[model samples]
Every structure is written in structure tokens, then in C-alpha cells.
Target: MTQPSDVLYYSHNLNPRVAVAVARHLRAPLRYVRADPMGREREAFRPINPNTRVPILVEPSLTLWETDAIAMRLAARFDPDFWPPARREEVMLWVSWSAHHFTSAGGVLYFEHIIVPRYLDRAPDHAATAAAEADFRTFAAILDEALAGRRWLVGDAPTYADFRVASALPFAEAARLPLEPFAHIRRWHAQLEEFDAWREPFAGLD
Candidate 1:
């Protein structure tokens, strides 16, 4: 008999950037719960996560939020090989890099420059946009250097770092950020698109 392990996902919009990380990391089918524009302001969603964010994981008795936490928990429970080295040190590196560094600087720049202005009708000036693009380019260059002669971030095989970093790239592309400048990063992003799961959420988003 199949055990019932539920994963309810809530996001501001269907294909949220961070939520995709959880989806890819978990390799689990998501049950999408439509998020209110003020979804984070709702107490209803707070029961699952006081912060009230999307990609929240409800696994039987436990509910987890925050992208890396959900990804780490899922990888630990369901995918040991997906997380190479399988050591606490390596796992921490991936999660911390994603949450603090990649998600912090890169994610912030993507939002402030592109997603916010385009989707939410917010005002962002040209200088801010340029700075954001420059930030993304900086991170991309760092990643390109890191991946030289290596296929993945932590090791040869793809790990949580790959998914987390890859998740951010699509937004950059959507923002019209040039990829021609970084061949390795472009190739890495292409590799991630080959997965069926990666294409699933993006199917009808266009």
C-alpha cells in the first residue's frame, strides 16, 4: 500500500522562484494551494508557517518552510545520492550558500530589478536595474569559475546547490539578462532543463 505523505505548496504566484527549488529538490509531486496576493499577511497560512510563504512542506505531522530547509529535509529523507558527499559539511555548504549568499544577493537583485517591476507594477529605476544585473553577473562569473572542469557545484553529480543556483538563472533569463557572457553557467542551466520535473511547473506559465 502506498503511504500518504502530503506536501501542500503555497506561493504568491504559481511558479514562484524559491518554490521551484523545493519542488526540484524534493522530486515530489506538489499540491498547489493558491496564494493570496497578501498571502503572507493571512493568518490561515500562518498555521503552516508563521512567515506565511510558499513551498511550505506538510509531511504528516511536520510542516517545513524556507526554501533550503524544505530542500534539505526532503533530500535527507528521500534523496541521499542527490546530495553528494552526503556529509553534514557539504550539505551545510549548499544550504547556506543558497539561503544566505545566492538567494540573498542574487535572488534579491532578480526581484528588485525584474520580477517586482514587471509583475507587481512597482517602480524600479535604470541604475537599480543595472546594479541588479551586475550582481547577477558577478554571481554567474563566480559559478562559472567554480564549475571549470567540474560538472556540478559540490561534486561531479548534480546536488542541491545545482538546483538552487539553477532556479535563480531562469528568472535572470526571463529578465532578459544576457547568458552569452557565461558559457559554463549557460550550459549548466541547460542541463537542468532536461529534467521532466523541472519543466512541469513552467508548462502553462507562459
Candidate 2:
């Protein structure tokens, strides 16, 4: 059987940006395809990802959805350092927390403040934004406490989990994320922002 080319279908959304940043960090020999699964190509992209999400990684005999899963595959294939064996479970701990708490809360704020007002051409839902801000502070406190002395989420260096947790930090300002009180998370995210890949993952995309 012939091996299929690794193609990453991505959008500029929070999750897809993480995938692009990972691929860029790894310098993986893969083709990048910009896709708008939720917008103009919703119907056309359904067959590729039934849930209609981007950051879909299509490799030989496999079509992967979910941002973390895509990041896991990319790390497992190109660089083990990003997903170290001994620290795998520890990394997963943070990834799970992000999906369940931090990122989830942050996504709501982004959607309500940024997405609703800008793309949807409607006023943001203030009630939802206020509720999300409360949740953001609640979860962010946990993250802030966790990062009190650590540079990264799991290991000595940045891991996939770090990217996963920091997924929404880049948009904190634009989304009006309630991050001002979380000094530790702000400090940690500042370090991630130093990286070109994290700062501008789509710098060269056409």
C-alpha cells in the first residue's frame, strides 16, 4: 500500500492555530491546507470531518479530528521531546484540564466577545461573557497555582500540553479574557509568546 501524504487542514481558529504551531515547531515535512470548516466550506468539508472542524490531519489510512489528537500524532511522529515517554501521563493531565476547564472557559469568552461581535455582526451576549469571565477566573486560578514555580506545564521544556493550555492565551486581549489577576499564567504565556511559531504560526501561509 502506498503511504499517503501528510496533509494538515487548518483554520485560524484557536484549535487549528495550535496544530499549525506544532507542525511549524517540528518542521515536519507535511503539506498545509487552509480550510474553513465552519464557514464557506461547511457542506463540502463534512465528509472529511463529520463534526465539521478544522485541524484535521489526513495521513495514510487515517483521518484525525480533535486538536489534541492531531497534536499527539504530530508529536509522536516527528519529535518525542514534545511528548516525552516518561512524562506522557503528566502532560496528559494538563491537556485534560485544559479541555475541560481553562480552554473551555476561554473559548466561550472568545466566541461571545470576538466571534459574535466581529464575524456574526451582532452584539455580544453580555450575560454569557460575564458568566464566562467568572469561569475563566475560577479555572485560571488553578492554572496560576499550578504554574507558581514551573516554566512549563509538564516538563523542563515546552510540551504539547503547554500548547494545549496556552491555546487561548494568545487571544486573551482580543477576547477580553479575565487574565489580569492570574500573574503566573500571564508570565508563562509571555514565555510562549516569545516563540515565533507561537506568536505568528501563520506568518507565511498564503
Candidate 3:
């Protein structure tokens, strides 16, 4: 049988959160195909992805778009434990906490304070930025308290939840979001950063 090839076509501006989670968990090295904002300009890419987002994953016979969806799919396929709780109620809790609370809150702060200035060449409005930052801090505080004595997000073991959250840290750092007092968060992030697969993906890009 032929081995499946894993490839991630992405850009520097595109963080590739889902790709990072899958790649790191599976210990699979990714082949990067850097495409312009205008996209690959090929009919092939157009058909595979309608929105034309970066971080498109091309497996040997599967093409996936949408970062979060791709991450969930990969987790289900390779590491079911990474997806969410095997129990239904816990799955609901994870989804509610991550989707409705964490990702939304973090995304606002990320887009307004970090992404806008870098990609759009202008900062977001002060009031809006302030609101988002407050949201993120509130969410972070809850996570920090939950992680008061634990090592990972879901359980003693790490999961995609940790990876998804960690992907936002570089942006938070870029925005000068101070983590000075959050010792557990700092330690958690440091642990995640030590992964060779995570660092390897950006080697040539940086």
C-alpha cells in the first residue's frame, strides 16, 4: 500500500490553526505550497475550496477546507480523544466553552488588535479593541482558574482544545497582551511551544 501524503498550502498571514493541531498531534510533517492572496489561480484549487482560504489540506485522496472543520475531521480520523469528550455531556461542555466562549472571545481580540493592524494596515477603533480585549481577558481568567492545578485543558492529557487555544497566543503576543501574571498559562504555552512539529512548519516561512 502507498503511504498517504499530507500537504498544507498556506501563507504567513494565515495562521493555519487546524493544520497545526493535526500536524502536531499526528507528528506528520507537512509539505507547504505557498499561494498568493489571489490564490493558486488554478481551477483545481477553486473546485476544492470555494472560499479560497489558505491552510487547505491535500491528503492523497481528500481535500479539506475550513480550518476548524478540518481539524475536527482529522482528530476523529486519527485521534478521537483529541476531538472532544467521548461522553455526550462533556462534548457539549467542551463545545460550549470553546466555540461559544473561548474562540469567539479570542478571535475578536486577535482580529481587532493584532490582525487588523498587520493585514489591514490600520488599527481597530479604540472602543472596539477595548471591548474585545476585555472579552479575551475574561475568558483567559476562567481558563487560568480552571487550569489552576492542571496541566491540560480537557484532562490530564492534552487535546486539540489546547492546540486551538495556543494558536492564538502569537497574535496575543503581537498585540502586547501581557501574560506576566498568568503563570499557569505561561507554563502551559511554554510546554506546547517545545514541540518540534509545531516549530518545523514555520522554518522556511520565517
Candidate 4:
């Protein structure tokens, strides 16, 4: 019997975008399934992920959620360049920093500016966005300082950490991220934009 390829359930959301990009970049053999967490299939999706999130990877005997874990799994199986071992500690440092300082801050602005207007269709609270923008600027400054002389986050080349740190960047323009003053970060992100996978990971996928 021909076994089915491992499946990846995904949506065109922030983290899923990165996961799909990593999977496609590595040419991982995954059958992609578009899942709607808040749709009628919400109940059906619960069996695979208690969080009812996309970017869930389901293999023949295993199921995994969380974008970082999925990205790491794919890197472990296909390409270690994304998480190079000799450079793994430095790579992980940026990834960890991003979770708490960088992406965490930008995510709030993204939610307030983009999600509120597009999905919720309500006026975003001005005070909330103001606070979020302040937080974002504080962290973005740290990132800017870190990237001043480096093209990539950890090593000479790009890694999963770059993707993790820049996860919120793709939505920057739409989310009104305060990025104009950070030349290094802008230059770095421009390089990532060179990748078709990063530019349009969900392109042509349902």
C-alpha cells in the first residue's frame, strides 16, 4: 500500500505563514490542508490540536502543534542549515529573544491594527494601540541594534531564528509597524523578501 504523505494543516495567518514557508523552502513532503479554526470544522480540528490551531503537522503516528516545534521538526528531517548545530546556540538565542521581546511586542500592534479592522470590524481602542506601539518601538530598537552589522540574525546565512524574529515583519506595512528608522532591520528583511517562499508561502494553495 502506498502510504499518504504527512499532512500539514494551515491557514494564511502569521505563524502558519512561517511554517508553510519553512516547509516549502526545505521541499518537505507534506500534503497541505487548509483548516479554519473558528469554522464548522472547529470540532473536527480539536482531535488534532486542542488549541484548534493551524500549522499543525500530523504524521502517520505523530501529531504536533506550535510553529516553532513544527519548523524545528522539518529542519531536523530535511535541512539543518535552518538550525545549524554548530551555530544552534546563537540561533536559539535570537529565536528566544524574538518570542519574548520582538514578535511578542509587534503581535499586539498587528492584532490591534490589522485583526481588529479586518476581522473584528470594530474600532480598535486607541489607548491599547498606543501602548502596543510604544512596546513595539522599545523592542524594535533592540533588534535594530542587534542587526546593525549583520545581514542575518545568527550566522553568515539565514536561519530559523531570522524567520522567527521576522514573523511579524511581513505584516509590518499593513500593521503599521514603526520600522522606518531601522535601516539594518529593513535591509535584513529586504534580503528575506528575496525568497519566493517567504514572499508568498501560501501562494496557489487553498
TM-score of 4: 0.95
| Model 2, global lDDT | 0.89
Reference-based lDDT, each prediction: 0.63, 0.89, 0.66, 0.88
Model 1 Cα shift for residue 40 (angstroms): 9.1
- Most TM-score-accurate candidate: 4
Q: What is the lDDT of residue 162 in candidate 2?
A: 88
The C-alpha RMSD of each candidate to the native structure, in angstroms, is 3.5, 2.5, 3.4, 1.7
Each candidate: how many clashes? 0, 0, 0, 0
Model 2, runs deviating above 4 Å: 1-4
lDDT per residue for candidate 4 within 76-136, as digits (tens), equals 9999988998888888888888889789888888888888988895898888778878888
Global CA lDDT computed for model 4: 0.88
> How much does candidate 3 score in TM-score?
0.78
* Tens digits of per-residue lDDT for model 1, 1-206: 65446665655342354465456545565555546424445777777777666667787778887766776676667777666545657756766765655545556656666667767876765676676667667766777787777777776666777777666666665555656788888787778767655545544332
